[model samples]
Target chain A: MQYERPKSLMDAASLLAGAKGSAYALAGGTDLLVIMKNDDFDAELVVDIKSIEGLDEIRETSEAYTVGAAVSCAALGESTMLKEAWPGVVEAANLIGSTQIQGRCTVAGNLCNASPAADSVPALVAAGAKAIIVGPNGNRTIPVEEIPVAPGKTSLEKGEIVEAIQLDKRAPQSGDAYLRFIPRTEMDIAVVGVAVSLSLDDKGLVTSARVALGAVAPTVLLVEPAAEAIIGTKLDDAALERLADVCSAACQPIDDKRGTIEFRKKVSGVLARRAARIAFDRAGGK
Target chain B: MSAIAVSTTINGDEVEFLCQAEETLLDVLRERLGLTGAKEGCGTGDCGACSVMVDGRLVCACLVLGAEAEGRSIETIEGMANGDELHPLQTKFLEHAALQCGVCTPGFLVAAKALLDANPDPTEEEIRFWLAGNLCRCTGYDKIVRAVQDAAQELRGS
Candidate 1:
């Protein structure tokens, strides 16, 4: 294997594009290293993006925040500003692995790995985050949900790189929360994950909302009906019931040893309701 | 394949080594530097048996590339002791019987040191959550938690 730590994004892209065999970008390398150790990876060229300028930075403004692809999950958890702005996203990303993994795992790597049960993808999607994808040609912005097209595949073209993930300026009277049901308290993959982001008007009426689910489909699902269910209401029992039902109705899960189809469906609804309730309370319900 | 030359600071000492492209930090520490304290219970990040601190951040050495350790400050279990005196966490772990086979002890000590360095007084929940990556297969976590709590108290001079 050839490991090339390019000092610039342009150089990195060219190196990746010009590889003769399997080329991979090394971020935090939590997942990539594991796969490589198991002999499942055949990489001839690897571009270490951490050497690139600003690729490991977290840029924050009042309007939005952009986390560089190589930024570790530990950095995300430590940032009071980032956590204050997007608690759900930070918590979700922090919950990916153990404390040690957080020190090395990148949120970008998590998205690129494209696991169906990714802890951070749902929260990123629910927050309307966009991934800034750069490639040999140039750069383009794509929604977080669109990046993961399948369970283990991404929509990124050859030589394309995720520069940073940007969360748009959040509106006031809004809060987001993420919850995943695993068999253990930690260090376990999500059997079912849900993220709910909602905003309330002056009267505490739900105005804008987004609900996303993970591990229930090929990719994380941004359930429109689930979002639609809670909008234009105060998230009362009826609205929340509809929200749960719609969220559950959108699942396309497969029966696996970890969870049956029926169990996942039920948990999706239950988790959706619980997550929405938390979001509602966090938004300072009147 | 040409070996990668890496310059790293471990335990306050500047160290240099050459490692292969596929070599992990844990491999170099154990094989080259003879820092055998950081065990390799599971090469994957799932087990924290190879946990270390890179630039003050707690990380599993197995997940870090050996070449990537260049110009980084690393702290392994070898740095956890002070001459003849064990660190408070180590002292408490021995007292609390936090180990069975002793394979996971070094990793736990390193991880706990990182935690206490950041937050001297962590809650029980915080300690459990922070150490969730370190697994003790032969023993349950009750003693480990108590050891950490007692160590924190000891370090606090309480």
Candidate 2:
């Protein structure tokens, strides 16, 4: 095995593209190191991209906020401007692991790990986030939901790397929130996760919204019907009920020791209602 | 695999070591550098027994590769005390009987010190949440929490 800390994105991409055996890009190493320790793991090259400039910064602009791929979750929680703008995304990213893990984990890593139960992907999807990718062919941007194709795989090409996750600036009366059900208080994976982002009009009616669910499918799901259920309503009981029903109907979960499929479907609705309520309140609604 | 020569700072001293690309910082610290303060409880990030500070941020040493420690500053439990005096958290732990088998003491102390360094006056709930990653099976967390509170108060000199 060989480790190369490349100072440039192209250099890192080239290294990964030219590797003979199994290769990986090491950002935080929280996941890679754990996987490397497995008996069946076979890794030949690790390209450390932390040495790349601007890859560890959280850049805010008039249009959007760009969180570098190597940026730690701890830094995201500490960014006052970013937190105030998108609290749900920050909270979801921070919920990945403990303080120690948060200090090392990255949202890009969480997305790339491609786990259906990843804490941050649902929130990012609900927030309508986009990932900026850099590859040998050049740069391209894609929706966060489009990156994950399966449980443990991503759509990223062999030489492509996600440089950052971009979130557009929020309009007035906009708020987002993420909630998950876990057996324990902390240090456990999500059983069912829900994230809701909504914007309210002057009349307290939801003008726009996006709903996402996790741990209930092979990949994080963006349920359009769930979002459309509350589009023009004030999130009253009927609107919320429709939203919950849509969320519950969207679940295609597997029965595991953590939860049964029926339990996941039931909780998805419950969490959607609760999360939408929180998002409604945050959006300055009554 | 070829050994990577890494030059980094540990406990405020410049240090140089040779390690394999696959070797973890915990392995290097315990096996090579003779700094066994950080224990390998799970060899995974789930348990914080191998907690340490890389570049002043708390992280699990077992989850970080030795090669990645190049040019970074690390703070382990060995650096928690001065030449002959123990840190307040250590003293408070001894006074409050915060340890049972003493295997997790180093990790707990390191993690608690990080919490105090960031927030001088953390509420009880905050302290518990901050130390949630470091598990203590033998001793219930009540004594450990009390010791951290006492240490924080002593450090604040009130």
Candidate 3:
């Protein structure tokens, strides 16, 4: 197979645009290699964009936190600013595989892979993350929720690559957390994952909330009704129960080896409640 | 196919080589450079037998492309000792009887070196967490954990 290492974004884009047959962008190669080995994918050419300088940066500006597509999960987990500003984001990155996998796995790859069980997608969706897509057509921002249309499918067109993930700069008077239920601890995919972000008013009432669930459907789902169940409430046991019920009802999980549909639905509710509780605590709730 | 030119410091020696487009670091280290200290127990990242340090970061060699190591410094199990004198971790592993089969020893040594280099004084829990990537099938990891602790103490005393 032909391998192309482009040193500039435009160069990479031009290479992608000029490619004739099957070609794929090599970010960290954590996921791509596995797919390639399984005989599930065949690529005539592989473009290594990692040599492009400035693509591995994690920059926080007055407006938003922009994390490059090539930034590894280990880098994200170790970023103190990211942990403080977007705790859920940090937690999501940390939850991907293990330290060894994280050393080479990129957040962009995780998003681009578009696995229903991707640990970072729900958290990013909950945080209202946006993808900066770059191509010959120019750069544009797409919502994280819109990036994945189905399991193992992405909205990215040919010659398009994710530049970075952008999150709002405003540190909400809120807390966020991600929790997943896996059969094994160290190296296992999530059976059900839940990410919650809650903004609390001064009086300890939840002013706004976002609840996202993973592994329970074809795409990482944002349960708006579940979030609305807790927003504007004190987030006490009753509100949490209502929210859990909504989350359980929202999922359309299928029975798989990892878990049964009934188990996933039940665990989804439990995880949603638990993550919401942690988020509420982090938001300085009583 | 474009051959990628990689120039890096391996085992304290500055070297340059051309790697095939699809070659992984594990393949280059084992086949091209003949630094077979890093073993590929599993081509996937699950098994840590192919652990190595790439620019001060402990990573699975199998997961990283050879081209990714360009301009980076790498330390393998072969680089641990200074001539005959073994590194503190290596000595401790020997003294503590950390390995039974010796297949996972190299990876454990490289991973322990990384941990000690980062935190000279790490708690047992920290050691366990840091070494979680490296797995030992023969030695239930109790002796390995003790060896790492002893190595930390010895390195700190020196």
Candidate 4:
């Protein structure tokens, strides 16, 4: 095995594109290292990109907050600007692992690892976050929800890397929240995760809303119908019920030991309702 | 197999070592540097038995490659002592009877130290959340929690 820490993005891409055999980019290594340690595992090149300049920064501008792809989950959660701007997004990122693991886990790595139960993906999607993809094709922005097409897979082509994730600035009276259902209280994968971001008008009606679901499908699902159900309402119980119905209807889950298909479907709606309520309260609802 | 030469600060001492590409920092600390305080309960990150302070952040040393430790500062359980004296956290753990099997002690102590360093007066909820990564099969964590709270109070007092 060859481990090389490339100082530049171009050099990292070149090393990955030119490697003789399988190559894995090291972004925190909370997951990749475990995969490497598995029996019969052998990767010819391991490119450490955290050493690259500017890959560990969290910069907040007037327009948006740019989180470097290699930024640790703990650091991202502790970022004051990000926490204030996108509290739900930051909290979800922090939920990926425990304190020890969060210290070494990255949001980009979590997305690229492509776990259907990725806690951060649903929140990022609800926040309309964009990933800055760079490669031989140059830089392009892709929605966080569109990155994952299947479990353990991503839509990113070979030699491509996500340099950063961008969450746009919110208008006044906006709030977002993410909730996940796990059998255990902490340190467990989400059986069902829901993230809701909404902006309330002066009259306390939802002007805009986005609802994203996780672990009930091949990838995190942005339920537009669910969002539509709440967008024009005061987020009353009636609208919340309608939102839950659509959110549950959007599931495409499989049976597993952690949770059955029916259980996940039920929890999906329950989580959506609760998250939306929290988000509404945070948006200054009476 | 080629060895990677790395220079790092371990416990405030400048140290140099040659390690394999795949060698985890846990392995280097335990074998190469003879700092065997960090245990390997689970090679995977599931267990925080190998927890250490890397650049002032708590992480599972097993998840980090030794090559990645180049030019970084590392703190293990061995670093919890000041020469022949014990750090307050270490003393409180003993005073509170926080250990039974003693395998996960080092990890708990290290993780608790990290929490106190960041937030001197953390609530019970904060303490539980911070040490969730460090799993203990024995003691049920009650004594451990008391130890951390007592240690925090002692630090705040002095």
lDDT of 1 by residue, B6-48 (tens): 8989999999999998999999999999999898888988889
- A1-286, model 2: which lDDT tens digit per residue? 8999999999999899888898999998778888898999988899999989999999989899999999999988999998888899999998888999999999999999999999999999999999999998889999999999999899999889999999999999999999999997788899999999999998999999999999999999999999999999888999899999999999999999889999999999999999999999999999
Which regions of candidate 1 are displaced past 4 Å?
A: none
Model 3, span A45-154: residue lDDT tens: 88888888988999988889999988988888888988988898888887887667887788888999999999998999998899999998898998998999998889
Instruction: Point to the candidate with the largest TM-score.
Output: 2
List RMSD in Å for every model shown: 1.1, 0.8, 1.6, 1.1
What TM-scores does chain A show, candidate by candidate in order? 0.98, 0.98, 0.97, 0.98
RMSD of 3: 1.6
How many clashes (backbone N, Cα, C below 3 Å) per candidate?
Answer: 0, 0, 0, 0
Candidate 4, residue A99: CA error in Å? 0.2
Q: Give the DockQ (C-alpha) for candidate 3.
A: 0.61
Fnat of every candidate, listed in order: 0.84, 0.82, 0.50, 0.71
- Which segments of candidate 2 are over 4 A away from where they belong? none
Better model by DockQ: candidate 2 vs candidate 3: 2
Model 1 lDDT, residue B20, Cα: 90
lDDT of 2 at A38: 94
> What is candidate 1's lDDT per residue for A1-286, written digit by digit as tens?
9888888888888899899898999999998889888766678987788978897789988778999998999998888888887888999999999999999888888999999999999999999999999999999999989888887899998899999999986777889999999999999999999999999999999898999999999899999989999999888999989988898889999999779899899999999999988888878776
lDDT of 3 at A284: 85
